[model samples]
Target: MDVIGTSGLTKRFGRVTAVDHVDLRVPAGARFGLLGPNGSGKTTLVRMLLGLVHPTSGSVELLGRAMPRHGAEVLPRVGALVEGPSAWPHLSGPANLRLLDAAGPGGRRRDRRRRVQDALERVGLGGIDRRPVRAYSLGMRQRLGIAAALLRAPELLLLDEPTNGLDPRGIGEVRDLLIALNEAGTTVVLSSHLLTEVEALCTRVGVMDGGQLVLTEDLDVLRAPTGHVLVRTPDPAAVVPLLDGQVVGRSGDALVVRGDDAAALNARLVAAGVAVSELALQRRTLEQVVLGLTGTGSDRVDGGTT
Candidate 1:
C-alpha cells in the first residue's frame, strides 16, 4: 500500500511557486529519501504532505487519508522532526519528553511515562534522561528529538536533516537507528543534505530541482551501470571514429563509449590497430546521478531552497 501519495502537488508563496505540479508515492514500510538542492521546494512539499502547509493546487494523501481534510485522523499516525532539535534547555531529557507526551494524544500519565522511557531506550538515550538539555551533546539532542517523535509509536516518520550538526560517529548512530526503525516496520521519509547517508539508507529516492520532481526511482536502478565504458587507449583520436557514434566523450586520456559491450568495443579498437590499455565499465554514483538530474554541477551534498 502507498503510505504517502501526491498529485499535481503545487505550492505557491506570493509570486513564487515553491512546488510545481509534482507527483510522489512512497510505499508502506519504505525507507524513502527526498533529495534536492536548497530552495527546490522539498520542505514545502513535505509541509504540504504533513498538512502543515496549504497547497496552492493539487492534492496530498498520507497513510491512506486525504490531507488537510483528514489531517487530525492522519496526523496521529505520523511523526515529524523538521529543521532541527528543540527542547527546554533547563529541562532534563526525560522531563522534556514528558511535556511533549502530555501535550500529544497518548493515553494516561503512566502510559505516557512508559512510552517516553521506551522511546528514550529505543534511541539510545535512556541512561542519560537525567542530563539537562543544555548539557547534552548535539548528537544527544538529535536523538532526543527522535525519541519525542517516536513517543506515540508513529507509523510514519518524517525527518528533515535529522543529522544536521553531528560528528561522524553521531551520523553513523543516527543512520543505524533509522535503519532499525524501518526494519521494525516504520515507513520513513527522510530529507537531508547528506547524499551518502541517503544513498546508504534509502530503498527509494526522489530528486527535485527548481520546485519540480525530476526523477524518482529505486536505489538499485539509480546506482546501476549507465551503459557506458571507459576505455584507455594509446590513441583516443584513432579509436574515436572506429567507435561510430557510441563515443560519449573523453575524460583525461580515456574514451567514454555509450555501449554495453566493452569486449566488442575493445575488439574493434584492436582491429583498428589502436593499443587498448584499460577498459572498465562506468557505474553512476547516486551523487553523479542527482547532480546530472538537477544540473547544479555542485559537488557539495547539501539541500537548498529555490
Candidate 2:
C-alpha cells in the first residue's frame, strides 16, 4: 500500500501559494526523498499531509484514508519530525518521551517506556535520560526529535531536514538509524536540501520547485545517465575527430566526453594513432538535472500546477 499519497494538493496563504498542485506517493518500506530549496514549498506540503495545514483545492490521503476528516485515524499511525525540535526546555529527555507517549494512542506506560528507551538507543542517545533538553546540543535535539517520532511505533515517518545541524559522525549515525527503521518495515518520507545526502539514502526522489512537484524518478534511473566516458590523450587537438557530441572540458592531457558510446570513439582514437592513457566512465551528478527541473537556473512560472 502507498503509505502516503497526494493528488493535486495545494495550499495558499493569502495571495501567495505555498503549495501548488503537488502530487506525491510514498510506498511502504521506502526512503522517499523530497528535494528542493528554501521557499520551494516542501515544508508546506509536509504540513498539509500531517493535517497541520489545509489545502485550498485538492486531496491528501495518509495510511489509505482522506486527511483532516480522517486525520485522527491516520495520525496515530504516523511518526513525524517536521519543522524543528519541539520539547520543553526544562523537561528531561525521558520525561518528554513519557509525556508524548501518554498522548499517543497506546495507553500502557511500561510498554511506552520500553519503546522510548529502544528509540533512544536506536538513535545513539542511550543513557542520557536525566539530561535536560535545554542542555542538549543541536545534534542531540535532532535525535530526540526522531525518538519522539517513533513514540507511537508508527507505520509512516515524516522528517524535514533531519540532519540539518549534525556533524559528520552524527549524520552517519542518523542515516544508519533510518536505514534500520526502513528495514524493519517503516515507510519514511523526508525532505532535504542536501542532494548528496538524498543520493546516498533515498531509493526514489521527488523534486519540487516553486511549490510544484516537477519530477519523480527512481534514484538509480536518475544516476545511470549521468555516467559519462572520460578520456585523456597526450595530444588534446587530436581527440576531437575521435569523439561525437560536444566535448565538456579539456585540460592539457585530459578531455571529458559527454556520451557513453565509447566503443566507436575508441575505434576512431586507434585509427588516428593518438596515444590514449586515461579512459573511464565518469559518474555524473544529478544535481544539475534536479536544479533545472525546479527552475533554479531558469525563468520562474506563476501560479503553475504540476
Candidate 3:
C-alpha cells in the first residue's frame, strides 16, 4: 500500500518554480529515501506533503486520503521532523515535547510523561534533566527534535536531515531507530542530502533534480550489480592474462573484469594458478548513480529559495 501519493505536485514562488510538476509515491513499511542536491525542492516538497505549504497546483494523498483537505484526520497519523527539529531554547527537551504534545491532538495528559520519556530514550536522550535546550549541544537538540516527532508514535515518520549535527554514534543511533520503526510497520520518508545515509538506510529511493522528480526506484535496482567483477590480487600481472579479453579496466593490483558472476571469475582465476586475494562483483555505487543523475548542489538556483 502506498502511504503517500502526489500528482503534478508543483509549488511556485512568483516567477520561480520551486517544485515542478512532480509525481511521488512511497509505499507503506518502506524506508523511503528522498535525495536531492540543495535547491532541488526537497524541503518544499516535504512541506507540501505535510500540508504546511500549499501547492500552486497539484494533489496530495496521505494514508489514502486527500491531504490538507483531510489533514486534520490524516496528519495525526503522521510524525514529522522538518527543516531539522525545532524547540523552545528555554525549555528542556522533555518540557519542549510536553508542550508540543499538549498543543497537538491525541496526546493524553495522563500518559504524556511516559510518552515523553520513551521518545527521549528512543533518541538516546533519556537522561536529560531541567537544563534548558539552550544549554544542549547541537547534537542533543537534533535528537530532541526527533523525540518530539516520535511522541505520538505515528504510523509514518517524515524526517529531513535528521542526523544533521550528530556525531557518528548519534547518526548510527538514529539509523537504527528508523530501521526498528520500519521493521515494526511504520513507513519512513526521509529527506536528506547525505547520499551515504540514504544508501545505507533506504529500501526505496527518489531522486530530485532542479525541482523535478528525476528518478525513483528500489535501491537494489538502482544499485544492481553491473556485469563486471573487481579483483584485487598481488599478482595482477598473472591474473590479467587469464581474464585476457574480459579485462575492461585496471589500476595497479586491481582489475575490472567484465563478467556477471564473481564465483565463476574467482574459479577461473584460481584454476589459472592466480592467488585470488580479493574478488567481488562490481556494481554502480550510490554516489556514481547520483552524480550521474544530478548536477552539483550549487548549480541549482532556486531564486533565493531552499
Best by TM-score: 3
lDDT tens per residue, model 2, 39-70: 88999999999999989999999989999889
TM per candidate comes to 0.81, 0.87, 0.96
Alpha carbon lDDT of each predicted model: 0.87, 0.85, 0.91
Error of 2 at 75 (Å): 1.5
| Clash count, one per candidate | 8, 0, 0
lDDT of 1 at 60: 92
> Between 2 and 3, whose lDDT is larger?
3
Candidate 3 residue-wise lDDT at 131: 96
Rank the models by TM-score, top first.
Answer: 3, 2, 1
Tens digit of lDDT per residue, candidate 3, span 1-306? 899999999999999999999999898899999998888999999999999999999999999999889999998889999997788998888899999999898778999999999999999998998999999999999999899889898999999999999999999999999999999989999999899999999999999999999999999998899998899999998876676689889899999999898998888888888898899887898888888898665744575532
Off by over 4 Å in 2: 233-249, 258-278, 296-306
lDDT of 3 at 175: 97
RMSD of each: 4.7, 4.4, 2.7
Reference-based TM-score, model 1: 0.81
